[model samples]
Target: MHKRFLIIVIGLFLLFPLLGRAVDSNQQILQLRAQIEELQKKANEYRKIVATS
Candidate 1:
């Protein structure tokens, strides 16, 4: 039982960093998506101006 417990503890220690990295990447992706949406909105406004002119 002690050996199994030791193994699980080691596994969790190793896994924590990988989970943290995944969270970081997801945050980056979300930020980029927001930027893209903002750019698209700007482009749409420019299109309207061009059409009116």
Candidate 2:
């Protein structure tokens, strides 16, 4: 019983970092998507200005 508990603890310890990294990566992806959207908006504005001029 003690050995099983030890294995479970070790498994969790290793798995926690992977789970944390997955969360971090998801946040990074969201930030990148937001930046891309902002850049696209700026590009559209520029296109409008050029079209007017």
| Model 1 C-alpha lDDT per residue in residues 1-53, reported as the tens digit of each score | 99999999999999999999999999999999999999999999999999999
Per-residue C-alpha lDDT of model 2 across residues 1-53, encoded as one tens digit per residue: 99999999999999999999999999999999999999999999999999999
How far is 13's C-alpha from truth in model 1 (Å)? 0.5
lDDT for each candidate structure = 1.00, 1.00
Candidate 1 local Cα displacement, residue 12, angstroms? 0.4
Q: Give me the displacement of residue 33 in model 1, in angstroms.
A: 0.3
Give the runs in model 2 whose Cα sits over 4 Å from its true position.
none
Candidate 1 worst ten-residue window by lDDT? 1-10
